[model samples]
Every structure is written in C-alpha cells, then in structure tokens.
Target chain A: MKVVVDGMGGDNAPYAIVEGAVQAQKEYGIEIVITGPEDLIQKELDKYDYDKSKISILHASEVIGTNEHPAMAIRRKKDSSINKALNLVKNGEADAIISAGSTGAFLTGATLIIGRIKGVLRPALAPIMPGKNGPFMLIDCGANVDCKPKNLEQFALMGKAYFETVMQVNNPSVGLINIGSEEEKGNELTKEAHKLLKEAPINFAGNVEPRDIPLGNVNVLVCDGFVGNTVLKTIEGVAGNIFSVLKEEIYSSFKTKIGGMLLKSVFSKFKKDYDYKEYGGAGFLGVKSICVKAHGSSDAKALKNAIRQAKVFYDNRVIETITEYIENSIADNDENIKAE
Target chain B: MKVVVDGMGGDNAPYAIVEGAVQAQKEYGIEIVITGPEDLIQKELDKYDYDKSKISILHASEVIGTNEHPAMAIRRKKDSSINKALNLVKNGEADAIISAGSTGAFLTGATLIIGRIKGVLRPALAPIMPGKNGPFMLIDCGANVDCKPKNLEQFALMGKAYFETVMQVNNPSVGLINIGSEEEKGNELTKEAHKLLKEAPINFAGNVEPRDIPLGNVNVLVCDGFVGNTVLKTIEGVAGNIFSVLKEEIYSSFKTKIGGMLLKSVFSKFKKDYDYKEYGGAGFLGVKSICVKAHGSSDAKALKNAIRQAKVFYDNRVIETITEYIENSIADNDENIKAE
Candidate 1:
C-alpha cells in the first residue's frame, strides 16, 4: 500500500519528514509519496540511502502555516503540501495520509477534500495517550466544539472501532466522560448520550469521572469536543507543571543534584513513556480514508511512527469497520423509533 | 468574630474537628462553637488546654454522611452537625461556618438554610488551587451542572470579589475557561458567556485555554460547574499519575533508591506546597453567610486552615461585597434590556 506524507510540515520540516518517510518505507515495505517543493525534499532525501522505486516525490508549491485560518487556508492553498497529500488519498492514489502540520489545516483539508464515511455524522480527532495502566483513546479532542447527543454517540462508536482496529484491543470498553460517575449525572448532552451509549453495540462502561481518566480504566473515552479538549489540555498542563516543579526542586541544592544525577536514567525512561512523540499521532476517525495528524513539533522518530500508524489504519480497514458499525446502529435506532 | 465548626464531620472527626477548632480559636482569637454530640465533642476538646470562654459546644445528635443525597439529607437531618452549624450562621449566632463534612451536603445546607444573597443567581464552590506562579480560584467547581450564560457571568463576579477580599489581590483578573483562547472559539454556552463576561464589571481577561490554567495567568477562572469540576479533577488525576510513575521508577533499582533517599526532603517540600490542605478549603460563594467546605479527608491542620479562611471571609465582609456587585450588575442589565 502507498501512503502520502506532507514533506513541508512540522518544526523539523523536510529533513525529519524525508528521513522518517524513508525509514517507514524501508521498514514497513510501503510505497511513500512525499509532497513539497521538489528540490528541498530531494536534498533532504539525498542524505539517506533507500530503495529508489519505493519512495517518490510529488512537488507541491505552497505550504500552510499554523497561524493561518484553517478552513480559509485549506480552501486557498490548493497547492499546499497538506492539500496535495490529502488529494492523493482522495483520488485513490494513496491508501492513507500522514501530516505533522497544523492540526486544524490538516483536519479541515482531509474532511473537505476526502470527505467522511457514508454513515458517519462527524469525524473526530482520537489521540492515544499514556495512562497509569496503559494507553487509552480520547475521541473528539477538539474537532467539533458544539455537539449534539447524536454526535457523542457517533464518537463512541468511531472511537471503539478505531481503538479496536489500530490498538488491537478486542471489543474495547467505551466510557462517557462526565463530572460524576452516575448515569443520571452530567449536562443535557452527556445525560442523553449516556443512555444512547448503553444501548449501542459496544462495551458501554457507564459514566467515567475526570479523576479516573489517568487510571486507564476504559479503552475508549468519549465526550463532546469542548469537554474532551479541556481534559486533554488540562492533563498536559498539569503534567508540565509537575515536571517543572520537580526540576526546580532537584536543582535547588547540592544533595538533590547528586540524587537527580543518580536517577537520570529513571527520569529519562519515564519521560520517554509519557512523550507525545512515542504515540505517533492522533487519527482523524470517520474520514473516508485514513488520515493521521502528527504533533506539530514531531521529530524523525515521531513522523516514522505516525506513518506506521497510518499503515496499520489502512491495512486493518478501520474506515470500513466504522462505516459498518454506524450503518447498523443507525438502522437499529430507526427501528426502535418506529416501534415506539 | 465567631465561627461554627461541624464537630462530627470528615474522616478524622470529632478529634480532628475539635482540635482544629481549638487551634483556630487560640491562633486567631475567634470564638468557636463545635456542633455534635456534646459528650463526644467535650472529650476531644478536653485534650487541648486553652481559654475556656472562647470555645463552646452545641449539641446535635444526627450526622450527615457523604453517601447521602445532599438536598434530601439536608432537609431530613435537621439535627445533624452540618445542619446545626449552618443554622448558627443563618440565625446570626455565628459569623461564619466551617465544615470538613460532605461537600454536597454542606453546600446544599448553606444555600437552602442560610439562603442566597439578594440578586444572587446561584451559589458556587470556589476553590483556591496551587499553580506554577501562585494560587488561582476555580469558581463553580461543582455547584450547578447545567448553567445559563448569566450563571457564568455571576460566577466571574463572585469569584473576583472573593479573590480580592480574601486573597487580598486588588482587582483580580477573571478568565472564562475554554478550549480555545479566542472569544469566538468555544461552544454556544461559552460563546455567549464570553460576550457577557466582556460586558461585565470584573477585570475580564478574555478566554483562557485549559493549557494555560496551571501557569496562573488569571486570578479567577470561571466556568459552569461541569467543566470546572472536570478541569479540577483532571489536574489532580494527572498530578497523581505522574507522582505514582515517578515513585515506581525511583524504586525500580538500587541506584535510584539511593537517589530517592537523598531527594526525600526536596520531594517532601514539593508535595507540601502542592497539598490541598495548605490552601484551606473552598468557599460557597453567594451564600448569605460565610460557608467553607474543607476537603473530605482533612486533618487537624487542614481544618484549622479552613477556619482561618472563614475568619478572613467574615472580616472582609465578602458576602456583603458580592451582594452589592450582583445587585449593581443586575440593575445595569435591566437598564440595557430597557434601552434595547
């Protein structure tokens, strides 16, 4: 299978993106199409030796920066790296697409260009994050801020299908993020969504409190984009604050400095485990084709992993599974409504 | 000034509650009334030697539990320690009330029994939490789950008043907690609330993203109870997970153990600074009288700090100031409606 890569995306740009594309193509045995200015991409690719036939360059003249308006940029920058890469997947020239570019621009381009699955209501940004027990998926991290109950129901189904296929967890348990653990607790959206989730065809673990999210009790956590975004950012904020505090304390005195020196390996390992780069990227689930948005600051290793993630998404037919799930669930709901 | 303490509250009750009361009375020179079974409270109070005239006991046989429904328990358990303590404030027998009991019960009792201030829309739980730079107040942490835009506007006002009077910050900045920083970048509720906040009398700092919360950018962060609760708990969950992971890494090997031992003091100090006990307790804003809800598992030190917070609230006439602010804002809103 062939996967398209945005060669002029992220902080490391052409060098890291080219290297990662080459690494992924060699290791995963997938054809890679890099999109950007041809000369710069070729210069970066020349630094590495790879199978010439497996890696090809598709030159795109323009680039989308993070600061530009997402929808407006996607509409205007037709020749941008992100736009070109998405078009490849849309036209069936590539099986999947990976970009470490502006998340908003990438998501907007993918949805507006490639389109959504037949039965899907909305595409969600599902990020696999490290938890106390293992990793879990937080769906609708920031895709749609204002959501209806139907939207959250779709998020749960999409999150479950994506987690089970990409993460390889069978019949993954899905939990609705709420302020309280009871079914009756939550605002109007979550309260109604909780009922729908209980009736959905997935393992519906009831309401999950925010305090229990880090424990990794469920494989998939579903919520509206507003709440999901807040939770995701709050976790990052708290972790960043704690690490900063720990660093200050460790360097405050001579005794702590020696202690920090001795535990250097331990700290490095812990940081590696919690790093966003290790998780590759967040998948824009419900899109017609596989689309992955890597972190904006991703390095070569992160981009490589993101390509691997895209390969898995394409191979497992995650989009088809989500479509089937949504179609069947919607049919059943229609039948229930008719009966009532 | 006189402060009433719920002697039968919290996990370490009447021992911790009684001791904390005596400590507050001795340190702050405020008259303290401990409400619970007279015999049990007296037994705990006997351990401390202090001014006899400054402390007294109020006999209340029943007790409200954390497991009980907040509103129902408040109505039925009239003689409970929490109920009696709230009544003392309602009747003007006490200047303020401190409870380490069930948060829900205390908040409900305070609002239902003591009543809300004139022109107050709703009472809110405002907690002072440790941030990177200093402490910040998260208003409506878990009071009203489903809130209108007006409720959030009032929360910003009450939060500003509380922070200024008790924390002694002059005209503290109030920020609306949202997924994005832009005024137009939130859900319907936040979008409308943003407009109202900008027009409100408080020092509106526009929208603050969740990622910037721990940086202490705003003195008061306002949101609906559902979002506020989730943000507060997510911070706790992430911090707890990080510390647990760090502990596991530090204990995994012999070298790390030596490092951990040497850094024990630094770790202890960091933990102490981040502890909830250091900040005292959350205040129930908009209540007619001062009402502070200490953490459920509060120790004597925590409870004493809660009493200290109540004393500050009483001395600063926070309720009076909030009432005036709400009344003026409501009048201005009415006038605006008329002009339109």
Candidate 2:
C-alpha cells in the first residue's frame, strides 16, 4: 500500500513531516510519497537514515496558509502541497493521503478534489477523543455547518462504519448528541434526526447529552457541525483551563511544590490520556478514499501515528464499506418515501 | 424589597431553602416570603435563630417534579411551590423570585406567569460560569431549543444588560458563540445574527469560538439554546471527568497518595474557584420580573447566595433596563422596515 504525505504542512513542517514519513515507511513497510518543494523536503530527509527505495518526493511549489479562504485557495493554488498529495490518491498512486495543515483548506481540498462517495450527502470530519473508558468518535466536527436531519442520520451511519471497521469495535453504539436525552428534547434538526437514527441499520443508542459524552457510554456521537464543533472545543477548553489552574496551584507553596514533584508521573499519565497526539488525526469519512487531517501543531510522533492510522483505515477498506452501507440505506429510504 | 423563595424545591428542600431565606433576611435586611406547606416551612424556620417578622410563609401544597412536563405542570399544579413563588412576583407581592426546583418548570412558570418584557421575543437562561480570568455569562442555556437570528440578537442585548447591571461590568463584551470567528463562518442563524449584533448598540465582540470561552476573552457568550446548553454541559463534563481521572491517578501509587495528601489544600482551592455556589444561580433574563434558578443540588450556602443574587438584580432595576432597551430596539426596527 502507498500513502501520500504533505511534507510542507503544520507548524513543525519539513522536519517533523519528513521524519514521520520515513518512520512510517520503515515500520509499516508502506510506499511513501512526500509532496512539497523538493529541495526543502530533501534537506529534512537528509537528517534521517531510511530505506531509499520505499520513499519518493513529489514537488509542489505553492503552499496554503491559515489566513487564506479554504475553498478559494484550494481551487486557485492547484500546485499547493495539499493539492499535489491529493492528486496522488486520485490517480491511484497512493491508497491514502495525510496532512497536518490548515484544517479548512485540507477539508476543502479533500472534498472538492477527491470527491464524495456515491449516495453520500456530505462528508463528515470524525475525530476520536478520549473518554472515561476509552476513545469515542465525534462526527461532523465543523464540516457542514448547517445540516438537515438527513445529514446527521448519515453521519451516524458513517461514524458507525468507521468505528467498527477501523477501531474494530463490535456493534459500536451510535448516539445523536442533543440538549437532553429525552425523545422530545433538542432542536428541530436533532428531534427529526433522532427519529431517523432510531430506524437506521446500526446500534442506535438513543440521545446522548453532552454531560455524558466523557463517560464513554456511546462509541459514536453524531451531530451537525455547529453543535459538534461547540462540544469538541468546549471539552478542549475545559481541559486546558484545568491544567493551567493545576500548574499555578501546584506551585503556590513549598509543600504543594513537593507534592507536585512526587505526583509528576501521575499528572503526566493523566495528560497523556487527553492528548490529541495519542489519537493521531481526524478522518474525513464519506469520501472516495481515506483522508486524514492531523492537528496543525502535531509533532513527529503525532504525524507518524497519523500515517499509521491512515494505513490502517486503507487496509480495512473503510471507504468501500461506508459506500455500500450508505447506498443501500439511501435506496431503502427512497423507496419508503415513494410509498408514503 | 421582598423576595419569594421556593421552600419545597431542589434536593435539599425546606431545610436548606428555609435556612437560606432566614440567612438572607438577616444579612441583607430584606423581607423573605417562603412558599411551601405552611407547617413544613415553619418547622424549618423554627430551627433557625432569626427574627420572625422578616420572614413569612405562603402556603403551597403541591410540588412540580423534574419528570413532569414543565408548561403543563405549571398550569395544572397551581399550588406548586415554583408556581406560587412566580405568582408572588407577578402579583407584586415580591420584587423577585428564587427557586432551585426543576429548571424546566421554573422557566415555564416564569414565562407563563410573570410574562416577558415588552418587545422581547423570548426569555433566556443566562448562567455565569467560572473562566480563567473570572466568570463569563452563557446566555440561553436550554431555555429555547431553537432560535432565529432575531432571538439571538435579543439574547445578546439581554445578556449585555444583565452583565452590565448585575455584574457591574462597564460595556461588557458580547460574543456570538460560533464554530469559527470569521464573518462568513457558522450556520445561517449565526451568520445573520452576526450582522444584527454588529449593528446593535452594545460592545459586540463579533464571533467567539468555543475554545476562547475558558480564556475569558468575552464577558458574555450568546448562542441559540441548543448550542449554549451543549457548551455548558460539555464544560461540566470535562471538569468532572478530569477530577475523576485525577482521583485515580493520585491514588495510583504510595508516593502519589502522600503527594495527594499534601496537595489537598491546593486542590480544594482550585475546586472552590469552579464551584457553582461561588456564582450563585442562573438568571432568567428578558422576563417582566426577576427570576433566578439555582442549582438543583444546592446546599444552604448556594441557596443563600442565590437569594443575594436576586436582591442585587432587583436593586439594580435590571428588568426595567432590559424592558426599555428591547422596546426601543424593536421600535427602531419597525420604523426601518416601514421606510424600506
């Protein structure tokens, strides 16, 4: 299997990207194609020793910055690293593509360039976040801002498919995120989506409130992008705030400072549980191929893990499974609509 | 000024509620009317060493539960403590009402009985949560399941009025909670609300992403109830999960257990900062009369603080200010529409 890596993306750019790609090639034994300015990528590649034949470089002169309009930049900057890497996947030169760049640009480039799966309304940005028991999937995290009930129902299905196939969970539970867990609760979109999700062919776990998300009661949590983004960011904000508070409190006195020293490893482990690097990257499900968007500040370890995540997603044929399931469900719904 | 207290509300009920009322009367020198079974309220009041003349009992035989339908229950159970308390405010027997009862029932009773301020489309549940710098208000948290652009615009105005009056923040910054900060970002409702808020007479901070909420960048965060509720609950969930995780980690080893003991005070101080009692209760803004809903599990301290909050709200004439602001804005819009 082959994977295309964006070599000039993210904060750590060429160094972390080149090193991660080399590690993935050596450990996973996958053919790797790094896309960027060839000279820049080569300079970083020279710092690491690896199998030469297993990795190749593709030159792309332009780059997409964080401030640019995502869709417009993707269309205009065809020679950008993200676009070149996507082209490799489109032309069957690679089975999957990974980038740790501007999330908006990567999402736009992947959707418009790689295209959507048949019968899919819109692709979802599915990120796996740490929960009490384990990690759970949050689907449609800032992909389609305004979504109809149908979009959320499909997000539940796509999320379910991704969880079961890639995470290898059996009959993963799917939940519709809402203000309340009662059937009649939530906004119009969630109320309608709840009804549709109950009838979808998956392990529907009723409505899940945001308070219960961290408890890991459900494997797949589905919502429109606006609500999903709010939940995701709030979780992040709270964790960060708590850590900052802890850092200050832990140094307030001599006794507390000594206590903090003794519990240093404990805090480290706790922080690791909530780290984004541990999960690698978020997957853009309902697309034609495997596409993963890593965190913009991802280090070498995170990028390497993202490449592994992409390879696993490709190996499991997740895209084909989602396509088949969604097509069948759409057809069934169409027939039901006709009869009604 | 007189404040009505729901003695038969919340988990702690007559004991905590009655004691809180007695404490408020003693500290603030405000007349307190407790609503519940006369005999039950009197028994709790007798346990407290306080002046009898400052406290009075209004008989309420029934209690609305968390499971009951809010609007329907409020209409049917006329003698319920929540309904009677709201009736006191509506009847001009009390300047404000404080309840730790079912949030849904309290919101329903307040809107149906006390009514909305003239020209206000909907009342909002605005809660003050602890942030890094201090506390910021989150408006419309589970009050209205769905909201239009106009409703959010009004929420922003109401939130601004509350923060400036009760919190005494001068020209408090108001932010429209959205997935992104860009002008074109967010769903249709927020996109339109953004435009309306920009033109509204307030310190509009444009779009504030959820991540910035904990950083206390804005004094007031406004969103549709669904998104607001999700953000509120997610922050609670994250804090709870982190504490649970920390408990496990701190007890994971003998050395860490010793560390935990030494650092207990630091942890306690940190927890106190985020405690619900510190901020009193949530304000039901845009109503004709002041209505404050404390946490359901509030103890005496929280309930007492909630009463103090109601008194401050009443003293500042917050209701009158909001009424005047909303009425003027509505008139200006109607005139603008006529000209167009």
Candidate 3:
C-alpha cells in the first residue's frame, strides 16, 4: 500500500517527517510518497541509506503554519504540503495520508478537500488513550466543537467501527461521556444523546462518567468535541503536573534521590506505557479516505508509528466498515418509520 | 462562633462526625451543635473529652442516605440530620453548617432552606483545589447543569468575592473555563460569557484552557456545572489512576520495593499536598448563610478541617460581600442601560 506523508508537517518538519517516512519504508517495506519541497525532502532522505525506489517525493512549495485559520488555510494554500498530500488520497493515488501539522488544517482539508463519507453527519477525530485496564477511543476529541444528538449517534457508530476493525476488539462497547450515569442526569445534549445511543445498533454501554474513563469502562467513549477536548486536556495536565512534582520531590533529599535512581527503570517503563507516541495518531473518522493526524511535537519514532497506524487503517478497511454501518443504520431507521 | 454539624451524614457518620465536633470545639473554642439521633450521637460523643459547655447535641429522628434524590430527600426527610443542621443556620441559632452527606441534598437544602443571597441568580459550589502554583477555586462545580451567559457572569462575581474574602487573594483573577483561550473560541455559553465577563465588574482574565487549570493559571475558574464537573472528575480520575499504577509497579520488583520504602515520606508529603482533607470542604457560594460540603468519605480529621473552614467563612462575612457585589453589579447594569 502507498502512504503519502506530509513532508513539511509538524514542529520537526522535513527532518523528522522525512526520516520517519524513510524508516517506515525500510522497516515496513511499504511504498512512500513524500509531499513538500523536492530538494529539502531529498536532502533529508539522503542522510540515510535506503532503497531509492521505495520512496518518492512530490514537490509542494507552500506550507501551512500551525497558527493559520483552519478552513481559510486549507482553501488558500492550494499547493501546501497537506493539501497536496490529501489530494493523493482523494484521487485514489494513495491508500492513506499522515500529517503532524496544524490539526485544524489537516482535519479541515480532509473533510472539505477529500469530502465526507456518504450518510456521515460529520467527521470525528478518534484517539485511543491508555487506561488502567487497556486503551479506549475518545471520539470527536476536537473535530466538531458543537454537536447535535444525532451527530453523537453517528460518532458512536463510527468510533465503534474503527475500534472493532483497527484495534480488533470484538463487539466493542460504546458509551456517552456524561456527568452522571443515570439516564436523566445530564445537560440537554447528553440527555438526548443517551436515548439515541441506546437505540443505535452498537453495543451501547450506559452513560460513562468522566471519573470512570480511566478505568477503561468502555472500548469507545463518545462525546461532543467540546467536552471530549476538556477531558483529554485535563488528563494530560494532571498527569504531567504529577510527574513533574515527583521529579522535584525526588531531588529534594539525598535518600529520595538514591531511591529515585533505583526506581528509574520502573519509572521509564511506566512513562512509556502512558506515552502518546506509542499510540501513534488520532484517526479522522467519517472521512471518505483514511487520514491520520499525528501529534505536532512528534519525533521520528512517533512519526514512524503514526505511519504504521495509517497502513493498518488502510489494510483493515475501517473507512469501508464505517460507511456500511452508517448506511445500514439509515436504512433501518427508514424501515422503522415506514412501519410506524 | 457556633457551627452546626450533621452528625449522621458521611460514611463514618456519628463516630467521625461526633469526634470531629469535639475536636473542633476544643481546638477552636467554638460552640458546636451536633444533629442526629440523641442516643447514637451521645454514645459517640462520650468517647471524646471536651468542655461540656462548648459542645451540645440536637436530637434528630431521621437520616438521609447518599443515594437518595437530592431535592426529594430535602423535601421529604424533614427531620433528617442535614435538615436539622441547616435549620439551625437558617434560624440564626448557628453561624454556619457543615455536612458530609449527599452533595446534592446538601446543595439543594442550602439553596431552598437557607435561601439565596438577594440578586444572586444561582448558588455555586466553589471548591479550592490544590494546584502546582497554589490553590484555585472552581465555581459551579456541579450545581447548575445548564446555565446562561448571565449566570456565568454572576458565578464569576461570586467566585471572585469568595476567593478575595476567604482565601485573601487580593483582586484574584477570574477566568471563564473554555476549550480555547481565544475570545472567538468555545461554545455559545462561554463565548457570550467571555464578553459579559469583560464588561462585568471584576478582575476578568481571558479564557482559560482546561490544560492550564492544574498549573493554577487563574484564581477563579468559572463554567457551567456540566463542564466544571467533568473537569473536576477527570483530574481526580487521572491522579488516582497514576498513583495506583505507580504502586503496582513499585511492588512488582524487589529493588523498587526498597526504593518505595525509602521514598515513602516524600510520597506521603505529596499526597497530603493534594489531599481534599487538608483543603477542608467546598463552600456553597451565593447562599444566604455559610454551608460547607465535606467529602462523603471524610474521616474525623477531614470533618474537623471542614468545621474550621466553616468558621472562617462565617468570620470573613463572605455572604455579605457576595450579596453586595451582586446588587452593585445589577445597579451598574441598570445605569448602563439607562445611559444607552
């Protein structure tokens, strides 16, 4: 499968992205198409010894800044690396595309340029986060800020499909992130979404409180982008603060310092488990083509893992499965309406 | 100062609650009225040695369970310990009230029985959470589920008053909790609230992203109940999960076990810094009288701390400050409208 890489994306653009693409090609033996300034990409790729035929470059001069307005950037920067890369998938020239650039620009380009899948209300960014029991998917992490009850229903279906196919979890349970577990215990949006989710075809686990999220209570946790974003960021903030505080405490005393040294290996292992790099990228679900948005601060290792994730998404036919799921659900709704 | 304690409220009710009252009475030299079944409260009170005049018992025949509906329990359980304790404050027999009962019941009873401060739109639960820099108050943590822009504007005013008066942080900055920091960002409620906050009579800081909360970016963080509740619970979940996982890892090996034992003091200090017991309880702001909701799992130490907090709240005249703040803001709005 051919995977197109945005050569000018992310904070470590060209250097890290190019190296990661080369590494993925050498390791996975997949054909790679890098999009950016031909000379810059080639220079970065030349630093490593690899099969020349396995990797190719498509020249694109303009690069979208992370601070640029998302929709405006996508529309204005026609020859940007992300735009050019998304075009490859739109025209069926590549199986998938990976970008670590501006999340907004990438998600906007994937939706407007490549278009949404038929019957999909809106595309969602689903990221699998590490939990105590295992990893679970938080859909619409920041794709659609404001959503309707029906939109959440679609997110549940799409997230369930993606988790079941890409992650290979059977009959993955889906839950609506809410303040309380009771059916009548939420704001307007969740109270309505709760009813719709219960009727949807997925294995609907009742409302999942944010406190239970870390326990991996469900395989797929669905919520509007606003609440999902808050939950995701709060977890990051608390975890980072704790680790930093621990480090300071460990160095405050000689005894604790020696203890910290002895426990260094265990700490490193635990950090790796919670590291976002190991999870690769968040998939832009409900899009017509496979699109993965990697962390902006990703290094070569993170980029390589994201590329591997994109390849798996293509191989497992996640987009196709989501499409069928939405279409079938729509048909069932129509039949029920006719009977009524 | 006289404070009323719900002697049958928390998980360790009667025992922890009674002992804590005696401790508070002895340490602070404040009059305390314990509300619960006379025999049960008397039995627990007999275990503690204290000045007879400082501590007294108010016999109540009923108790409210944590699982019962908040409003329903407040209305039906007329003779409950929480109800009797609240009545003591309402009737001016006590200066404040402390309860470790169901949060909903306490909040509902405080708002309905004790009443709201004049011109106050809604009452909020403002909890002083420990952060990296220090402590910050998160207003409307789980009170009003859905709110308008005007309600958030009031929350900001009330939160600022509480922070400045009780916490003694001069002109504490107020920030609207949002998904993004930009003025144009966030959902309908936050966007409008941002505009109102700018015009409101307070030290209005711009929008605060959830990720910055743990760093104590602002002294007062305001949001609707749903989002605030989600953020609070997510922090708790993430912090608890990390510690649990670290413990499991520490015990998995002999070297780490020795390290854990040596570093136990440092770890315990860190835990104490983040512990809710040390912070006392969440103050129910915008109420006519002081009401502190202690943690449901509070032990004797936590209950004592909560009593101390209630006494401080009453001494500082927080309710009077918030009432004046709201009334003046309303008058200012009226004058502005008249000028327009």
Backbone collision count in every prediction? 0, 0, 0
Instruction: Quote fnat for model 2.
Output: 0.88
Best by lDDT: 3
* Model 1 collision count: 0
Off by over 4 Å in 3: none
Chain B alone vs. reference chain B, TM-score for every model: 0.97, 0.97, 0.98
lDDT string for model 2 (A318-337, tens) is: 99889988988989989999
Per-residue lDDT of candidate 1, residues B1-340 (tens digit): 9999999989999998888888888899999999999999989888989788999999999999887889999999999999998999889999999998888889888888999998888999999998888889999899898899999999999998898888899999999999877666888899999999999998999999998899897999999998999999998888777778889989899999999999999778767766899999999999899989898889999999999999899889898889989999989989999999
Query: DockQ for each of the predicted structures, in order?
Result: 0.79, 0.84, 0.81
User: Quality of candidate 2's docking, in CAPRI categories?
Assistant: high
Model 3: per-residue Cα lDDT over A215-246, one tens digit each: 89799999999889899889888888888889
Error of 3 at A109 (Å): 1.7
What are the per-residue Cα lDDT tens digits for candidate 2 across B174-240?
9999888888888999999999999998899999999889888799999989998898889888888
> What TM-score does model 1 achieve against the real structure?
0.95
In model 1, the Cα lDDT at residue B255 comes to 96
Q: What is the docking quality class of candidate 1? A: medium
Q: Judged by lDDT relative to the true structure, which candidate is superior, 1 or 3?
A: 3
Off by over 4 Å in 2: A334-340, B334-340
